[model samples]
Target: MVRFLWVCIVVAFCFSKWVDGFVQYSQRGDPKTEIINNTLMVSITLIRGAEAKGAVCLDGTLPAYYFNRGHGSGANSWVVHFQGGGWCSNITECVARTKTQFGSSRYMLPETGFTGILSFKAEENPDFFNWNRVLIPSCDGASYSGDSENKEAQLHFRGQRMWLTFMEELMSLGMRHAKRALISGCSAGGLTSILHCDKFRGLFKKSTKVKCLSDAGFFPDEVDISGEPTFRNFFSGVVSLQGVKKNLPRFCTRHLDPTSCFFPQNLISGIKTPLFILNSAYDIYQFYAILVPASTDPNGLWDNCKLNLTNCSPSQLQIMKGYRNQMLNLLKPISKSKQNGMSVTSCYAHCQAQYQVMWHADNSTLIGTKTISQSVGDWYFDRAEIKVYDEGCHYLVPQ
Candidate 1:
């Protein structure tokens, strides 16, 4: 126990240093921009009448999106992507969030680089390169599904309203006449894509081809290393504090609790729209935050392993394999669907579709011969039935 306590102290100090370095790095502009100069930067566009429509962010600031218009053969095609950041479960966390880009548009960068699936370059994003792309920021703290407000805290949980306002605004801007459309996101934004997939399809005419893609958003309701419901409890808090119950899918809320419905595992099967799921079998975020949180690993036994999968002990690797199997089992039902597509790789990373190397680089991560971009594109265009899974663990350092 004493050794464990010592490890904890060491880990804590290292974490503090990392956070400090991150702050300094952020001030210099997005680190990715430095590495990839060819990225296309798109400016933010705040909704004109969002405040009047009660479609404001957590701090009541106007909600916004970044858009890049399409051309030629893709002029009528649209890609709506949601920006992901972690959520705030309680009033204290929510209040803290209002000061950051996640909860308020005020802190967001005036312009952000669009890479990965949002990239406009044909070589980088072959299938959707020329398609009109829209990126909606997740600034309301509830995956764009909450609808209640806390007057005392001066918080506005109007994500649902904000989503509707975005749709209405985009329709007026040209989406209504789209020949094809796709809704996609990563992490929390990925959950938003799933939550609103059917609704997005309903917005277009029956002839318009529409589908949804969720990247690194399949958070399971499993117990942590300590056999405690850590993530479940956190999700429960978010649901209660944000009044998310009323907005959950009726089919799910009718049987399970609101917290359960928030999990993609319970909600994906019920989605009527064609959906594609892209996730890392050993998602790094889930490995640290959900499977073995700091509270669960007080001794810091997982400190090294969490940071680098290659550092894991044989026993730890076995445990991760079990977790991977669990995720695969949950995904079995969806894999059987001819209309749905999946790309579950054994990479120890999170949110792949948004990064250039992971999406379509020469050495990009792949299952069989298809890169992530190819898999998604093939599924989107019905070129093949993609239900590929990686059997061997590939501990590639996250980019």
Candidate 2:
């Protein structure tokens, strides 16, 4: 227990931001990719309770952010992106993460290139390039929800505090006067976006247009192929160990378990703010962590299948198809929601918008012939009624 608590403190201390931890594509910021360099990284100036509450990373560093000022008519618009990486459920993983870019700011680059939703070039990011943009690094092992504070344990699970401090700083930088605002994140960051969507909307006046977008964040709470609830168990551990119950949405806690509220399926229905869900029905992360976790496949029965979808046997493919169906089943409620819009495709990948090719390129994956960027732009501006886009694997762009 002592070692685990120490690991937790180290993880929090060394925490840094990641662009998109699970991106499969590379060569970002190239002309072909259309992800240009536009934003500059800036370390946070004021950290509320940093000294007393220990809201510091493993290296005793503060959170770093990348911000770009808007110009022309976009001067009043703001978009904040929360960086994403997977979460650490145990001490070993958390301790190890603090040493890598995902957990420790010490190893992070002083500057990071902004692509996808953060793209500043009008040609590439057609709709939102000029909006005042901020990219927040998430080093908290708890998806910015943990609040456990035990000095004897030598742990500081203050993800909730960190988020509040970061938001306060951004608001001071001019988010409070924004005409329009959008909060988005990918993977674990995607989950954070969902959890904080309503709170973000409340930050501004009702007259201000506020919404949320989540990329590859709609993680389901279904049993894996092995008939085990791997993700649920993992979330239970996160909630219990980090004391995440206090940070969960009150509406959800009134009826459901705190860990259950962490999942988007249960959380979204309760959010008052409008939201857009951009995810793959066959999310690659779910394939690895939820569907066939290492704990369930201890003998490595799913080794090849997890690495390469093409290597799966006929029966395994059938199982994957069922999993996709389950995702659609889970999404049925949100599809009917008037306040929510979705672009869930059947691609066997995760975090598509982080790459320029998938965001708005000629060869970008399409949902009803519209690229992810086009769809999100149209939805954000209320250009048209955005509905859920799910055409199955046949419509998936060749990865």
Candidate 3:
């Protein structure tokens, strides 16, 4: 217990205006041939975020190994995979740069990550099934970077800015490939799903592409973005940023703003975008940590209840709401509901030799064919281990 509390304290203390981390993955950014028998994957490096500095984080392309099993003139529905990082974070950058900075040290994505969502366990999911992953690049805090009192200012700004650019860039790429595409992210990235819904629609429609699938990025609704101290200013230091609020739209978020502001209503309402929200029974990290309930934009849910129901069947809405409710209650005062990392470690080896649980799933994308204006929303948690039961190889995904 002391150890667990210690880790939490460290995380909370580091909660500064904007704590940054970086990773550079060199996998091909392209899925493999065997996996190609499943789906086509294409990586649309958005080319935005932290660009104010003018220097591209890294020029080299990372390889993505996908498995495809669909038919198309290379024009199939695509899924844009985003990894988990609760915004204001650098987990992705850290992962991508593991080899460069750490060098084959104990930093590469361990085989365990592939074996299960949790680094060392396999109970939440039996077959670690996540595809189309991105080493979530660095985020931008825009101009709201001053007030140290309110940490969200920075987190919200960074998420809004980074996600908007991601959507636009993804839309531009989907324009020439699949019928539609999927947009997904975990933690803050999932939050990105709801916030950027509006902007994504306009761009996709303009290109005549498809809609988005927002996984568990939903937080009741946003109230007001304006807070006591804005995080934009604090973020300026990280991106070689310049100017003030006046520089916005024209210079700043022009490439960073999520569709939330311009659209008002969560984008889910405006367009008939299909979204698949998945969350864990113990996803308190997002619920308790990120959700500033009173502050979430109210109009955010404006689009959800009306106008967009034709496609969002009752079943879909029910499923989404159910998980969201579970999310709400569990996160009210969010604490690590999942088993503690320490508990997972063997206590100097149990008296008897006990087998540990390992859950995993594999996914692949094939961009072998090309279509235009498409997307797939398949964002989900890396895996939130609610309770570390010794369950083995069970299919958690619905069949």
Candidate 4:
């Protein structure tokens, strides 16, 4: 699965706009760097005084983010993006993550390239290219919402604290004065955007145009091929292990279990802030982890089919179609809301907004005539009420 994910990324990069430029590095306090080709490599900024606030990662390392200040018309506009990595549900899994960048800042690269929505090049990210872009790394192992600790394992599940600290730091850095602001994320980070959408709106004045974009964040509450609630069971473990129940939306938890509330399907309707959802109808992560997990297919019935959609048998294709319909059905309420927007295509992929090719390249995935970037821009600016859903499946093998 890891190899297949890299293949998808490499294929996306192949279709992306690449230019020639010099590589430059900056000192600690300075976060911005010149755009090298289409990618803007930004330095990481560890949250100041995070230890005092107990805002730490799984390994108790300080939380960090990469920032690039906006200029021109977008200077006052801010885009705070939550980084996405799969979550660790159990103590064993969490401990394992502590040794990697996902759970510890100690393992993170000093700097990372910002492409897709975070790109500085207007040609690559036309709408908000000049806006202040911030990428908060996913080191807490819980989509920035957990708030507990495991003393036995020496782990700190302080995702909620990390989120607060990061927001406070960004506000101090000038987000408080923003005329417009957007909070976005992909995968788990996408889930973070949904979970915090209204809270993010509360941070700004009523006049401030604050909105949220969740890319591939809608993890559905569905049964696996073996008729087991795999995702639900996994989420229950995460919520119980990390104490995520307290951070969940009250509107949802009031009636549903904390585990159910964790799924975006149960939380989207109550969000008062304008929200845009960008997801593929057949999200590959769901196909791999939820619908047909290795445990469920002990004989590896889906090994090849999961890696490539075209390799699926007729029955497998039927199951996939059912999954797609289920996702659309779950999104029905948002589809009717004028304040909300969506661009759910029948692509066999996940996390589109963070890739330059899928975001706005000439051959980018499209819903009707608009690329993901264009559709998102139209919604954010109120230029259009975008609600695009593709009827046909678009299958491609990574090469």
lDDT of 4 by residue, 1-399 (tens): 999999999977765523221122232355756655556788788886999999999999999998888777987999999888989899999999999999999999888998889887788899988888888889987899999999999999999999899999999988999999999999999999999999999999999999999999999999999999988999889999999999999999999999999999999999999999999878888888889988899888888887788898999999989999899999998899999999998778878888888888878867888888999999999999999898654545431
Candidate 4: C-alpha lDDT: 0.88
Tell me the lDDT of model 3 at 154: 17
Give lDDT tens digits, candidate 1, residues 1-399: 999999999999999977754422222222222223666777788888889989899999999988777766888999999988978899999999999999999999888888899887789999998888888888988899999999999999999999999999889778999999999999999999999999999999999999999999899999998899999999998899888899899999999989999999999889999999999989988998888989988888988888788888999999998999999999987798999999998887889888898888888867878899999999999999999988644545553
Candidate 4 clash pair list:
none
Candidate number that wins on TM-score, 1 or 2: 1
**RMSD in Å for candidate 3, one decimal?**
20.0
lDDT of each: 0.88, 0.76, 0.30, 0.88
Give lDDT for model 3.
0.30
* Cα deviation of 263, candidate 2, in Å: 1.2
Q: What's the TM for model 2?
A: 0.85
Error of 1 at 58 (Å): 0.7
- Residue-level error in angstroms, candidate 4, position 137: 1.0
Error at 36, model 4, angstroms: 3.6
RMSD of each: 14.4, 13.0, 20.0, 9.8
lDDT, residue 22, model 1: 42
Q: Which ten residues in a row have the lowest lDDT in candidate 3?
A: 368-377
Where in model 3 is the C-alpha error above 4 Å? 1-74, 89-175, 205-209, 220-272, 280-282, 286-399
| Candidate 2 Cα errors over 4 Å, as ranges | 1-54, 58-60, 150-153, 392-399
